[model samples]
Target: MTSTLVVIGHGMVGHRLADRLRELDTAHRWRVCVLGEEPEPAYDRVRLSAYLRNRSRAALSLVRPDFLADPRITVRSASPAVSVDRRARTVHTAGGEPITYDALVLATGSRPFVPPVPGRHLGNCFVQRTVEDIDALSAAARPGRPAVVIGGGLLGLEAAQGLQLLGMRPHLVESAPHLMPAQLDGEAARVLQDGAARLGLHLHCGTTVVSVDGGAGGLVRSVTLGDGSVVEADLVVFAAGIRPRDDLPVTPALPLAERGGYLTDAFCRTADDRIWAVGECAAVLGRCHGLVAPGYRMADSVACGLTGHHADPLDEMDDSTELKLLGVHVATFGSTSGDAGTAVEVTFQEGASRYAKVFLHRASGALLGGILAGETGSRADLAPWVGRRPTADLESVLFPAPPFRPLSP
Candidate 1:
């Protein structure tokens, strides 16, 4: 009895699952069908901002050229699964096609969150998410105009920098006291703020957007801040945040996260054993990992389960991330706490562009975690030692090694 699997998304995580299944299902035990609402196949959304500069759709593609050639796999673009008839084990698409599957995987990914402010639907307001979004923004981007990017997160910063690259003045707004509130400590955020300023992005932190008002022709002309201050702008881009795309039909009405996303077990399995969720849509242990690395790990776990391997349930995934935002390098990993004085903390802040800090067990000197804001010179090496036993040679890990005047060895 050949089992058919209907994957209801084709984003990075969905595609990864399909690739793994194709690789492992040597006996062809399962035939696969992937549904993507987008007109094009899965592409690298991580680099979506680069679309403005590159303008080549082919370059952002994550789909293999031969993906469609596989005899056991089929892909349907521009088709979204509208509803799931669980009793019948079928998925109904917007195109009026019913796809039957012995098992279903929901990887609908996420959607950009647009805050409900007056005139949000104004002409020049956009959300930075899909390739089409960047394309549309790029079309409206003109030299010497100003673009207001709402949010100071990674995506928001990316949009700001992309607009700056296109010769447009970019202003960044954030409700948080600093950028990347979830990832960076106060000092680290200060460092990142300095970097953004260097890249020509005007900062508006710790304020809210009151409203966006339109001028003649109903295009975005100015924006009102929380403090009643207004700024002239040609366009507004919302990179606020993302919410899981969990509205799609799921048979049995799978449990959803309080914040919005499909709730699942560590194995990525929903309430029904035959159904699974992964990627941004899967909320494991009451939290959704918006990053791609954890999504990949979940994809691998689901693949192992479907391939008949008793893979251990995903637990304690390393959420450490390192990336360059607007040409600023920022990285953080493990526990960030050292204020309790339980651990020894060493910090080095060089001017406004560089800050590095590492925490170690006070007694044994074991590496705990660290923060690298501006210029991180090979500090990534310390990530692997996060859980390792303490080493006596903490001098090497310090920003500046202690003076070595010993016998010229």
Candidate 2:
């Protein structure tokens, strides 16, 4: 009998996994179905902000134009998986179609996590996750319109900048005392805030949005703060955070973490050996990595394992990350949380334009984890070295000064 594989969610990792499976097994003996809830094919959700700021639709496409034409694959758009009956090996769709499968892959991914604040459901408020989200916000954003982004993290900053691109004045409202609180320290966050301001984005740290005022036709007009001050806003984009989408109504208890992610082993397999979960939905090592790289790696590992390849389990310590955000070069790897060590921590800063930090284990000279900002040259050179070498070599490499450059082009 031909094996059937059903992949839920047509996001980045899901679509890539489907493509990889078809490439590895070209015999067309096995049937594959990719179900997507969205109306269009898989697109790059990572760059959705760019779409809001006038980027062409072609730039956001993740799959090739001819992807749907593949014979071995069935692309089902506007179809959402409503339930998964693991016992029957069938998944029920929103349209009441029960698709039976030998193997099931849940790549449900995640959705924007909006807090339970008052007036959150008001019009003129958006979450920048989908192409439709960008289209709606772009149409509403006009020149001199006051825009506010709640949550001063990566997406929040990007949304603020995107609004600025549309000639709207953007203000960043963060509840934390510092910006990028998850990745940067107080001093480092200050540098990021300075850089943001240079781009005409206002930073409002340590402020909470108590409620959104939508007196004008249920469309957001302004945000009321905890301090009882009202900041006028024509539109608001909530990039506060995201939660994994795992709403399958199954009777048998599926292992799930406290954070609502599927508890999976290193190979992205669930407690049930035949079933697997990958991407943002899987919580490996008791943590859910929201980044795309880890999700891609998980997808590859599972695909390799299914095809009889010598696939290894995921490493518990995946401390390697490097990327540039909005022209700011930032990289962080290993252990930002200080460990019990005998070693040294060094930091170098060049005003608000450049910063570099390193943490080392004192006794063994192991490179724990570090952060780099503003120095594109150093990040490009050091990120790989940090991943490959132990602490001793990192110590011998000697520290270098950070390169200073203005945030603006």
Candidate 3:
């Protein structure tokens, strides 16, 4: 009476689905099979930079030792699914093994987007994605040397920070006018830029890398900027963005979203009901959410659908994010952009290190979205009031009074 569920790509979100399924399937109604392309089991990629500090792989592992020991759950590491036979409901692996499944899920996740610039394929160029990538970067890092980090977003800043931790001077380059343009407003970005400068990070904003020049042995030497300037570099790390890995080979090609990723319904189901997708691989309603929270929600939805429970639609997936880069706290929730000019804005600032801005509905006082930079102590408290009006006064909500402290004797 039991059915088989095969999941491809044993990343964080993929493993969550298997774990959730086992938790809900108390009757042992389903057996799970996880296919991972990496030789090691799932690890915390979000904390990948931590590996640079401790040099411990086990510390980043997301899987518990005993979790995979269950007889109902089978894990095959270093086994990448090469193709899927939709008609036969079979997944073929690179090792020439075929897995049959009653229900199949794609959690292939995403790949780091590398921009096409000359010498990008040089030996010193790397992408910040996996532990192995970090290891490679650590091996190549030399103290006091200059390193160029492409992109100035969350991941790029993290990579730059990691390199700085490794004793390299990091020069961050971004095509955008300011850092973290996607997550921060202009004022917030300015605050972050000042903070970054204080941390000894050289930033190149509003410019693109025209080309990367390499020295002997095909190793990167320097990068040419669009403004006819060049920055010397011993290494370059790309953290521009990500694209979903939805191009997996299938007998009949699966439809893809316009922005890339397997097209899926709100329930994370593909055109074929038996096949589903979760995580970055699933493009629900023609949009792909790059954050892990939304991907976890998608995984839960698919698990519920497979278990005969009412699956929640992807409409409620929260894309809010909180981050700390080089000792600076930044948080963004809901719609931070008021470009359409339909919302009323509230702003507050204190010195060079603190800034907060919230957008409200023009007619209703309901929260539209907001950005917090420098001080994010209220992030957890403010997140829940994202779409709804706050019970407390707007001033108190935006700037909660500091916790009382006893005076020194």
Candidate 4:
């Protein structure tokens, strides 16, 4: 009997998993069914903001237009998995088709988080997650419409930049005290905020939206803050955050975290062994990794385990991360803890656009985490050492002079 593998989200992680499975067991006659809720093949969601700004749809295509030529993989666009009958080992689609599978993977990724505020239902309120959303927002937007993006994280900042390109004066509202609170420290957040302001983004920190008044004709007229202050705007985009969509297939009894995510063991398997979840939906151990790299690692581990190989469940995704955000280079990693007194940090600032910070555990001298701003060259090469949990030469590895210059140079 041929084995059937049904992958629910046809996104980047899903596509990669399907391709990897075919590579591992080609002779076994495995049938791969990829279902995407979107009406198109998987596209690079990471570049959605760039698509909005550059007005280029071709840049985000993950699979070729004629990807269906692959004999082993069959795709269903605009179809979603409605429910899964664990006992029958079959999935029911929204269109009332039953897909029986020996193995089921829920790559049903996360969705853009929109907060509950008055007038949020207004017509001009938008989000930039899918191509359709970008098209709608692009059609409704004009230069100098006074747009406000709620959230100061990576996505929010990126959307703000896109709004500026559309000729709108954008302001960012962050509930946290600093920007990119999950990725950057207070000092680094300040640097990022400065960079954003230079790109014509206004910042409103430590503020929450109380209500949005669409008193104007079907458009967001102004947003009232918790402090009774209001800012007038013609449009509002909620880039607040992402939430995993687990409300499908009749809401399984799978354990969910307090912060809203499906709980899974180290191997990315839920309580039901036949159904394995990956990507943004599964919370490995006790934490849900929001980034793509850790998600991909989880996909690989599950894939390997099913093929009867020894692959450890994902653990400790090297707290360090470095990236170029809207032209400004930023990095952070490890335990950047100072109040616990378990780590020591040192910062070096040469001039206006150069800064580096290194954090090390006090007793073990192990590099916990660090950051490089304004310079991000060769930062990825250090990821392996950080992922392996070895005691690094903090001073030498981060601040190598001349011939052994560190990544930031």
Model 3: how far is 375 from its true place, Å? 2.1
Put down candidate 2 lDDT per residue, 1-409, tens digits, no spaces: 5688999989998988888787777455568899999998788888886786556777888888466777768989999898888888888999999999888888999989898899899999999888888888888988987888999887787788788888999988999998778887776676677677777787788989999889678899999887777889999999998888777775475889887888888888888776888888878755787888888888888788777766778866354556555567666776676554544677666666666677767765556677766643344455555433443434223234423332311
User: What would the per-residue lDDT of candidate 4 be over residues 115-159, giving only the tens digit for each residue?
Assistant: 988888997899888889989888888887798999888889878
Strongest candidate by lDDT = 3
Candidate 1: pairs in clash: 366-390
Error of 4 at 401 (Å): 8.7
Best by TM-score: 3
lDDT by residue for model 3 over 367-388, one digit each (tens)?
8888888764457767788678
| lDDT, candidate 4, at 345 | 65
**Candidate number with the higher TM-score (3 or 4):** 3
Model 3: CA > 4 A from native: 339-341, 401-409
lDDT per model vs. reference: 0.83, 0.78, 0.87, 0.76
Q: Which stretches of candidate 2 lie over 4 Å from their true place?
A: 26-29, 317-321, 340-343, 376-378, 387-409
Worst lDDT window (10 residues) for model 1? 400-409
Stretch of 10 with least lDDT, candidate 4: 400-409
